[model samples]
Target: MNPVSETQSQHDSAKDAFFMNIEDAYLTALKQNPVVENGRTRPQYCYYDGPLTDIVLHNFIQVPADNFSEFFSHNHLPIPELIAISHEGVVHFNEMPADIIDEIHQQRTQYKVVDYIHADSFFADPLLALNVAKQRNRIYCGHPTIDGLQICYYRGELPEHGIENLLHLELDQAIEFFVDTAYRLPTKIELPDELEDELKTSIRSGFETIVNEVKQQRRTLISQLLAQAKQVTPKFHDGEPLKIMLPSSRLTTVMQYCSRAVAKAFEKRGYQVWFYMEDGEMETNNLIKFYRNYIEFNPHVIFYVNQLNNLALNDKVTHISWWQDSMPQITEHKALRWRGNDYVFSISPVLDRHLALTGAKNIVRQHFAVDDEIFNTDGDIERQNKVVFVGSSYLNSVDLSRPEQREIVEIFIDKIDNGEIVTEAMAGEIAVRFGLPPAFVFWNLLHYAIRDYSVKWLCESTAMPVEIYGRYWEQDPDVAAHFNGELKHGTQVADVYRSARYALVSHPFEINSQRLAEAAACGCIPLVYDCRDVAEKPHWDDACLFFKTRWELLEILKTQVRPALSPTVIAERFTYTAAVDNFIKHSNIGELSQAKQSRISMFVGR
Candidate 1:
């Protein structure tokens, strides 16, 4: 047989087996709750029992076997007679007993899986389910069922059920599939306006509480900053004005910590430092307002982070942009954007070379250091034996739902498996096809895949107790099981680093991450990804333990990763004080230290 015909046959056989299993499960559900004479022929709502049902509705199993006829009496909704079936007292997605499965196979009735997990199993074949759902309205609902209804609705996939307010069902658990009878009977699949209003009220109250908590945290951070500033020693300089340009208009907790540290460091160095930024705003064309602030502040030097904005730069004002991701990770467009700037700063050597090709006058290689005041283990307690990872999910930036991007990423992974790394140019071609920015496409998909795979491998392979603290990871059951908890910025993070045996640091795009430096500052041993070409910085020497593969990392973990004195000793070079000294020497800023400035200039020139 031809390859195509064989593949088709395999798929057909799989589909047939899946249908058999689902049919058996459905029949078993019916057998438990026998509908009276002709009840099978009569229209009724099928409510399959699942673990989530307990959390979603109070006594859902006790929710009148009379269907929803009396429950939704006053509403104009087509409340069908409900056939409620309890699974052999199962809570999660697991195998039912063989007798129960046999019983289900004996019964002959269409049913729906109440939980999303079961829905996935039943709707394994989208085309088959879509056709079946359309014909009989008694098949597993795929995208429009629950997960991607908003996307499907917007894409004009299923308009037959015109933008149904999913809350109308008033059940906490997602309804897996709907039979045709449910939609055909002109059912108002929406909560009544009053009930919706009540739901909104509850949601609003919860949101407000969270908002208040965040505000309190911000206020506390500000107070802590004020206290720390008083303890900072101010050194005398001829008084040069320095302005630190932030990466974002809105500062996250970590950004706020870094920004404050830099500002304080400069303040201590006798530079009249100010941060000129509008919080929570992204105004690319706000040059007028920016210039007004510059005029008021009258800053001599400006250090921008992440991206270089198109600003009117005069000889009097030194425009320096600190870029992190460089060549092979970032597109040429990013390098081009830095043109017209006075100086370009980068941590990565590849980025420095890439920016040099842009004809940038001064491309200085710098490091993203840790703030001693924020992340040091000065008063830290004894460390535990837990291996912790503190970082955000890599998948946040990528929209994996996009088929074109997903297909490209799949191909990219295959290439990686074949030992061929994807280049920016190759990623750019895929980006062009998808009408996406090449840098974003490259980093989002490739970097995301790298981190995702590495972290999963670490948690699964390591012998030590692994704990991850970050956002969006808890959404995956496999990954979530390893999650200890989330930690906010500031001392909480420092405590996490100090308390853990080793902080696992993995950055796909860069050789190093801020976490590596921060972990070191907190006297935490950093177990890093071994990529000497990327991590060519000599500063990492004697400061970190490296692993080229999962097995190597696992071996390190088994050996009991511990704090080495070198990490803490080497961490001093990455402090805010060292960072300020480096900045002054490299940029030729301030009047006090000509000898120091000359030495730094010569070092940078190398």
Candidate 2:
């Protein structure tokens, strides 16, 4: 082989080895410094000593053209020439076209520039790297790498430390930091008056359109509900006895007992009556049974204790909702509207008047009645000299912390002190005027404030020992001493009334409380609170005793004798039979039956 050819081959081999060593050093450096991509860490090749990319300056502070390089260099950034200054303080480089510069400036806002960077790093727009450093208080810069521009974030805020102390962030992390920082800075541009007016006009037009659509939807819903209600045609039975349905489920014990007594009263009058019972569980099955029974029986009348039930929707049949309590005590405001063949029987005349004022149909002032069999003074019992009160103590249960509740109680107490009868209707009216809950006001007035105060006065003022048989009396240590222990309703309560010589009764609304009648039935003279309404009742003076003040009550206890009214006289008037007769007369149920019979006869004749 020739010596020249061999020397040339050896030189070429040495050059290849030198290049390989340089490549190995580059690869080693890349492995030591990694970059994060889509949450995965990989080696990145950083260019430390190479031709620098041209910096596109974002002059948010509007620094002078000549001072740009010097100002950036002081902050440890590379010096680059500024080719163009945008209308919005952005500097372009690398000889960009005039049209392209205009397009960038129009699309970009000072506040939204950071958002553009976050999205595809501004499509690698080159402005992001330098602009981010200039905007932040603490600027961090690293060698431009193949992975893209590296920005370090330390606990959200950049640290004023060396490069080694800085922490490298992922793409997502960098976006979050930039977005947070960008929002913190104030916006540099303001919209023109014309543009601002246009935006407001557009928003108002859209809002009005939405409101109209919603109103149309609400009207459509109401129309559908009314149509559905009209569609329900109840099945009527011909030539059969007029059936009555008494719903006895989901009621308080007193209501349940009253329902039973009413059912018996109807049965005694030669009308078929049925009690619908439910135990609360298996509601779906019970409802199915209820509907099935209702369809088969085809009742002429459905009686409810408190508020109107769903049966009111069946306009074909008569619905009698006998309210023993106040309207607000058992139902929401919407239930006040009674349409179709619905009858509302309120115990208190005040409540009946309120119902009439609200345009409620068939509003009857019905007094509560007692079952003569259960309440009569039949059993032989020793009578005691003490005055007895039977009811719950609501003072312990009332939440007086609420301003509205406390105010209601205070008002009721004031009325009682003034010898005024504050009825459930008055309480409900007060609740509406004050924007308070009606049920809350009524309950606190009757149970908590009035009753508690009355009982306290009766027990504390009288030298004679007073007996109280109810719950929560223990809450007041003074009242607890007079508490004779709890007594079960009906037979047990009747026995106590029979044993007592005088029954101390205090009612804020009417003198027609069932308790007063029950005490009278047991031959116990009722010592009631004196009110003008009491004088209005026939033979009220013969049946019970009345006092205006605690001092008057004390004087009565010491000197007054029991009334001359007999137990039989009280029994005949306040009995369930008499109540049912009164209900039929006032509610025009007899007239309804005659009308039905006339219609049937006319159809047969035709």
Candidate 3:
């Protein structure tokens, strides 16, 4: 016999045996009655009997035993002169009623039929039950006489009988029932001490075999990954200058700009820097490519954004993971453990504490800086009397079905309305309590809720004309009316900032935003939402105005004047050069500093 044929035969035999067991269980259940205590039915054979019945009845219209004749007449279906009603309320016909049966079968094509099985017939093949729920039109069973089940109607003009809505509820309930039933254990049985001891020994041996198999599989996977990494040729030489490698990612556009700025900063400091391009592959493939790049470049330092997976690749090389976003915001890198040589940089103190709690050893608090070449102005462009906001509207993407996410958005709105600060820590604590994804709660829900509320309030309450420049603002008609055309990332955004007299900066977590730096560099006074604590003393505080509430922001727009700082001063203070210096100061990269100083001395002597 062919091997494939033999394997298929074995599978069929096993499936037959499985269904036989279900049939036997159903036959045994028919002979017993459910125990009733305090007028409530206690399920004896299957634990899911009660819940399944309730779900079926809730989504379907059940015809009582006495009303069958009236129902058949009302629906214009012929009823047999003599019919037998079973204990389960299924109608059975004696003698051949071929014409009537044909008519009933024709009705099945137009109306959805749901079989409401009694407790005695409560053996549901979980796969079949799920398929029925997916159909959203029918719940099929065996012959009415065999299963002793009654058919329920799901077609009607009533709102409760809406097929789509009812099927959604049915699908959710059926999934829960099947999942719970699959995990339930059978009733315990008493056995002889010698027999039980033998069974325990057999189970322990089987468990050890499974554990060994898992370990072997893991080792094989690692070996395959290492082999793939070794196929690529090295990209650097042995006698080259000290090198820094920055791997590109598709996580966000902001990360891409930051990487370019960092590369330029290191190049100026007399270090060879290069960016490893990403080819838009799967994450695992990208990870393999990253390993290959590590082996090829052999750089002294590797800088990445929000990724810590390659920290343990080499101990001698320094791995810098600058987390501009919060830890919870990047879900993919959460499981990667940090190494000793890994330097983790966070923009917010709240995020720093979060990393500490998660056992990160070397964490440095750093602020984001703008690329001077892209965000600087020539002091020639005419400044407009307008305030510009450049960000995507997160509120339009919110799913209100999730109560926990909706509650977080409401809390942020309420706080903003009452002239109170909604900090990142508060949103993070609520996310932890509700077991919700922190990124969704903080960034998507709370962040956009605040933006929507504040922007709408500013447009309606004050005479100041505000213009938005991003996507999804059209979701709200009122906000869309004030939306200016979208601007491109690099020079266009800088040009707009240079033309505007004021730039509105709203952050979800009160963290240092790149927008503040960019706006200030373009000589635009930043109107920042007051959420960060005063102790942090953000760099832009001296060059920008802060507003705590909508009222305060209104007053600032109406009365406050721009700060006295020049664009050159603000640009020098917040450029990527200053940012990289701060990073090198915190990091112990002394050799690069010495090399930079030597180059400066040579230039001065020349």
Candidate 4:
């Protein structure tokens, strides 16, 4: 993943950002040159002789819009029939021609809209929803067309019947195409005579000896786009020209075992990376503002972790996405709503299946490589019986539907507290109050798991009071007040993991509990629940234990388990090298950044 070498090879990379930036650069060069405005190379577009500042690329003809059906119609590209969309019970066949409606209704049995949440039902933020609705409407109906004959119509909470074709992909083939493009060096040769001969020969060589020069040009273009794009929505960067938009809520927990792995991949790949503050909210992450202010935060390419957030609604679209982590627990699970365009990347088989059912594009699956620093254990060696769970209960709302989540939280809290957790204060914290979004309305299970579950289990049984700590728990006086014997929440929280016999995870029924990995990293034997989670990965062997009932948990505690990862082992685990290496190998956006610079300076040059 040597970026230096990569830039040397792919020189045209910098030219990909937009015609807006280069238009100004080229205009400036034209102004500086003693050139005549002749027929052969007259200034096709007007430019400002002074600075060319007003010649902004953001100003284009009509506002940028998207919709395959409309695009096809405008371009006169052949397209097919679209799926019907139900809005508030009124079935609106996507742009159904006036004549096609009655004929189709008579011939085709009307499929019910199913009163499911629609793109328009997003009431709290009508404007934002409208913006997204414009895009989602395209995917909902545009792809279902097969040369104008509707094959399927989607109108429910669950995906339509047999939608497997949407996600069908030859992903490995795509990767092979790019990965197989090995390092190419520039070919130094003598000049050829005749214009046609020179043109033919130059095209043939493709810069074998000038690979670095080309890569530098590409890197520069990407950086310039980064800088200009930032100004569109400057608030996202706040101030610095370097920023990372971490659209994470509980990824900290999910990636406890996976973070260092990913971090190392990003760093080793020659990416100038920084950890940015995340709004941590699932609903209001203000992505558009980030795009507007991209110049303030000069990243070559934007990456969002997993599938929770994407840059689809940003001021300008970007090649913005990351590989999804394990979501096995989420399979066959019903979503509150499904907006295929809401995500740009997903490994969920359902995505492709839905596309096929409704006529969508193929989704490519790319995994975020594992960083050895955090995920580098040789095997599930004989560790210990101390199961340590690290997460909060607040995320259950997003994962569980209204009816099922209540049942899940109640069951989890009861197992550890013997039904003593539903106190007035606890209930207040967990209840759907203060009008939070339905998806974010779940109880703080991570905190409750620590306080109610772990505390009750230890206080009632002979197990030495299981240690519990996290960033928020350590800082809250009210939370601290509950722990009579332990030190208050603060930085001294690491000690809690050191003494634990088994880590505990009593999260709601969903896929991918991150705490399982966190506990493993800390060297406490993991005691993860037997319930399914979204991430499907290898199970814990002798290194951890799985429990389905309180009885099993107690039996295991009484007979087996103790802390295995010593403080020294945990300290030695911050190896971010692999994550960095992978980031370099996977990302070529940086090449665009280097190509635009005029000089071979030390900061970014070879």
Q: Give all candidates' CA lDDT scores.
A: 0.51, 0.58, 0.56, 0.35
Considering summed lDDT, which 10 consecutive residues are worst modelled in model 4? 146-155
lDDT of 3 by residue, 187-276 (tens): 112222455677856644544454455446545645666665435332333334567888875434677778878899988977788876
Give the Cα error of residue 401 in candidate 1, in Å: 5.9
The C-alpha TM-scores of every prediction are 0.52, 0.55, 0.55, 0.36
Ten residues in sequence with the least summed lDDT for candidate 3: 13-22
Q: Give the TM-score of candidate 2.
A: 0.55
Residue pairs with backbone overlap in model 3: none
Task: Judge candidate 4 at residue 405 and give its lDDT.
Answer: 47
Which residue segments of model 3 deviate by more than 4 Å? 1-239, 279-290, 327-336, 400-411, 424-440, 461-464, 508-511, 564-570, 591-606
Between candidates 2 and 4, the one scoring higher on TM-score is 2
RMSD of each: 19.2, 28.0, 20.6, 26.7
TM-score of 4: 0.36
lDDT by residue for model 2 over 1-606, one digit each (tens)? Answer: 111232342233211010112223233333343434457654332112222222322222223334433333323221221132223432111222345334434443221212222211111222222334333322111111101122322222232333321233332343333322211111111222455677756644544454455446545644555455444554434575577888865325578789989999988997789987653321211333455566666677888887576532566677787778755544433335565677778777656655666567667767788988889878879888878899878775577777877887778777777767776678889889879777677766555766787788778755576899986676787787888877877899999999888887776556767888899888888888776563336437677787766666777788856676654466567788987887788764687677767878887899
Prediction 3 TM-score vs. true: 0.55
Cα misplacement distance, residue 565 of candidate 3 (Å): 3.6
Tens digits of per-residue lDDT, candidate 1, 1-606, equal: 111232342233111111112233344334332223333322222233221111111111212323323323212222222122225643112222345334444332112222222111122122222322221121123321212121110111222432232112212211221110112111112122445677756654544454455446545644554444324322322322344443333333454456667767878876667765542221122333444455555455666665554334444455556666554424363445443425666777657666666656677767777777778878738888777888777666777788877887777666654445466677888889879887787778877765665677677754667888876677656688897666877778888888887888866435456788888888778887665544555636566887656666778888865544557765766777777677676664654245435656676699
Q: Given candidate 1, what's the lDDT at residue 367?
A: 73
Instruction: Tell me how far the alpha carbon of residue 209 in candidate 2 is from the true structure, in angstroms, after superposition.
Output: 39
